[model samples]
Target: MRLSNKLSHALSCAALTLAATPALADTVWLKNGDRLTGTIKVFDGGKLVVETSYGGTIPVDWKQVKTLESDRELMVKQDEFTGERAKSLKAAEDGKVTLINGEAPKTVELASIEQIIKPKPILEDLVWKGNVDVGLDYKRAETDTDDYDVDFKTTARHGAWRHNAEGGYNRESQDEVTTTNNWNAEYALDRFLDEHWFWQGRVSYTRDHIEDVSSQRTIGTGPGYQFWDDELGAFSLATLVNQNDYEYKDGGSDNFYSLGLKWDYNRYLVGKTFELFSNGELGKPIGGDSEYELDAEAGLRYKVTDWASLNMKAEKNIVSGAKDGEIDETRYSVGFGVGW
Candidate 1:
């Protein structure tokens, strides 16, 4: 009879332990007024172990805890660009709508929140696009010059493969039409090596022409490095060597060298960019002494909708010796495009 009584007592204790386990998994309010909801794995020696549902173990201090409760939900925030979600606990007891998947605790003003609902993480593929532009320009020097240009660009990306193609045509007053074309293709295999460093390689080609003045062509390939990666922004550096051919007026042929930096700044109001150029040149002039050129440009892009945008760019030409001096080129156009 004593043996049976002992077995019954042991079974009763096991049942009570199971029932109390979930109760200990309740919400914990810290002395600093922070709130957390998870299964408490340890609560001894003024410390605690919380097994969060998002699959992580957190250790916290008992002194930092104010009051422990059992009926509140944990909230978090998310990144708008990367669609990455992160969780954080509440810091104080206030009537505020909390983001359940954000990086930090956010006090969503009652007036700002149109509605309070469960937030879900956004999962979507990267977007790809294609565009075209047609415009007219008036050019006059010692002679009357009138020109019209039609440009088209197409871009496609799937996984690591990306391709860009551009072509343009310009007609001069002398009934001479010049055609220009350029293309770039790159394959990016991104490796998340501890979240901070990456390496990439790209190949590109360019061909440009101007009636009788000059015609230029180039082909290059190189590797690049990325140092920072976050929602705020990132920086990268690359070096490339191109085989360039320049044919000038008066039947003169010369070769030029190309080298420059590619900077990406997506932090402030400016959107996105791509710049490739050479400032220093080693080429003979047709009639004058050899000259140097400084070529740079800034472009602004505004997205009016998912299918359209406006692009405006200003280019500068600062040459050591040239007729009519340096000139600024401005182009503005509204275009409609589609992407996947």
Candidate 2:
């Protein structure tokens, strides 16, 4: 009885060991190299016991085992366009699957792919300079004039600041032989105070000659706030003070100071300015005009490349006192420029 009991205990332990082993699924590669589905029950020295979907166990030689498949699903959805499919068994080992030409197979570890789908760098950030533009203008007082202009401009940015220099010449010979010449130089510095609030300082000089009789020299400085900075574009608001010295062949020299608001919508666009100014000189006290002036301008800008662009502007000037006059001016220009 002791021998029989010892034998029974050994048999029970053997049965428990067999029950604890996991049942594996079989991946059957067809003769034509296609795949079929089944489960594997036992794999001994030289034979495999496979369980088919029809609920029968069949024994086959190990030499006939063309492929093996895990029961786990190993596919991942790649994109919204293409659909999903079973990753090849090789992909499961590598932890990643790649579908090429919608059919070829490639595999990579999941950790190796962490950087693949990340955001790409912006194209605008990579550019330093290039040029091109076309524009139109119209101005009316007692007489109306129409003008068309084309311009090219360029710019460059370095470490903490950028500098720009540009010049353009235009001609309008309808009623009078009027020609316009303009040159501009500007410098801007980007400053960071905290995270959300930052500051910018800009200095710009401009020389404009109109109709050989009127010319203006302007120098301006200002502080600006950047509200947005991203790959698409940037938006900022600035308060500026400008000094203008005007020389007219008929009129005397006039000096003016302007306080204005400026906005830059994008790398290639700018808009909206409202200016209030005071002329420093007094003509006559009793019957003379007041020295205060108001000016407003709106314009559009386009960047052809990092270093070139075109601009169109319309401005209205209103003055007070004897020197008070209303002037409507429209100008279009393309410029080639460089900066750093």
Candidate 3:
């Protein structure tokens, strides 16, 4: 009798624990009489994202939802109102939700909800993503030739400010003679004035080991406009007035003012398995020996997996009408890289 009672008590406790585990999760009912239990991530763009232990992150069509319940304080926006941080969510009638806000529960239609977002800390919600690519070539036996290149770009965003940094190095040697050798780095900071406008400050430096123009530096400030930034793509354009300085190996140097235009664009296609991107700057010297300067690159990235990609791009660099004559070059490269 004692043994049977002990076993019965153990089974009862186990059953209660199993039942309570599911009550901790939010619940959603579909029109097809199916029920889903998970933590609601967000509802945006006609999709409700949920984090589930069984299916990972899943996006459900908003139209198929009958009702939903949550115990989370989520930020929700309606068609004509700003975001409201509700205290919790409780199930209501079909196609309606009860927002528990400590006073009276406000009922809203699901169709009128424009967006739902989880609130995150301002300082703790920084986003960092970047890519690193490398290319190499080597040949031997007849004419000794070697070429190596490395390039990297990173961006970080916090609140209203965006930071960008990129740099690259390239070297080529044929017949024991170095034909091309240079490295450059640049950093730019942008502060958004609003959703579509911003102000920027930037500084850049470049050094060439085997060229007449050995050193170059620039400082600039500008205003910019952002077209759109979302899950699919981003694009921005800016104009700057810059102070440029150039130094030559022939004991010569020049400094002048220039107006420059810059653009950045990227798009994802084929269900985000491929991306197309281009960014560059063009400068017209106001008063200098250099007539026009151009630096640009356009590329395509094919995602092999979530974290790895194959990249191909073409780059052009020119400083025309310089003291050492026109300097023009174009390069094509294929590389392997990783991105986050």
RMSD (Å) per prediction: 16.8, 24.2, 5.3
Which tens-of-lDDT digit does each residue in 1-340 have in candidate 2?
A: 9999999999999999999985655465423454545654433323444556664445454444444444433322232112223333332432343433336655544333211111114422122432344555677766666565543334443323444343334445445545544444445554444322335555544444553225555555566666643322345666666666555545665666666565544432121111111111111122223344443334544444433434545433334442423233454343332221
Pick by TM-score: 2 or 3, better one: 3
Model 2 misplacement above 4 A: 1-131, 135-148, 152-155, 164-168, 179-213, 267-326, 331-340
TM-score of 3: 0.73
Cα shift from native, residue 266, model 2 (Å) = 3.1
- Deviation in angstroms for 323 in model 2? 2.8
Clashes of each: 12, 18, 0
lDDT accuracy of residue 141 in candidate 1:
62
lDDT of 3: 0.84
How many clashes (backbone atoms < 3 Å, residues ≥3 apart in a chain or on different chains) does model 1 have? 12
Best by TM-score: 3
RMSD of 2: 24.2
Better of 1 and 3 by lDDT: 3
Residues 134-216 of candidate 1 have per-residue lDDT tens digits of: 44556566555455545555544222333445454444454343332222222223322223333433333323343232445
Give model 1 RMSD, 1 decimal.
Answer: 16.8
Candidate 2, backbone clash total:
18
Q: Between which residue pairs do clashes occur in model 3?
A: none
Reference-based TM-score of each model: 0.40, 0.40, 0.73
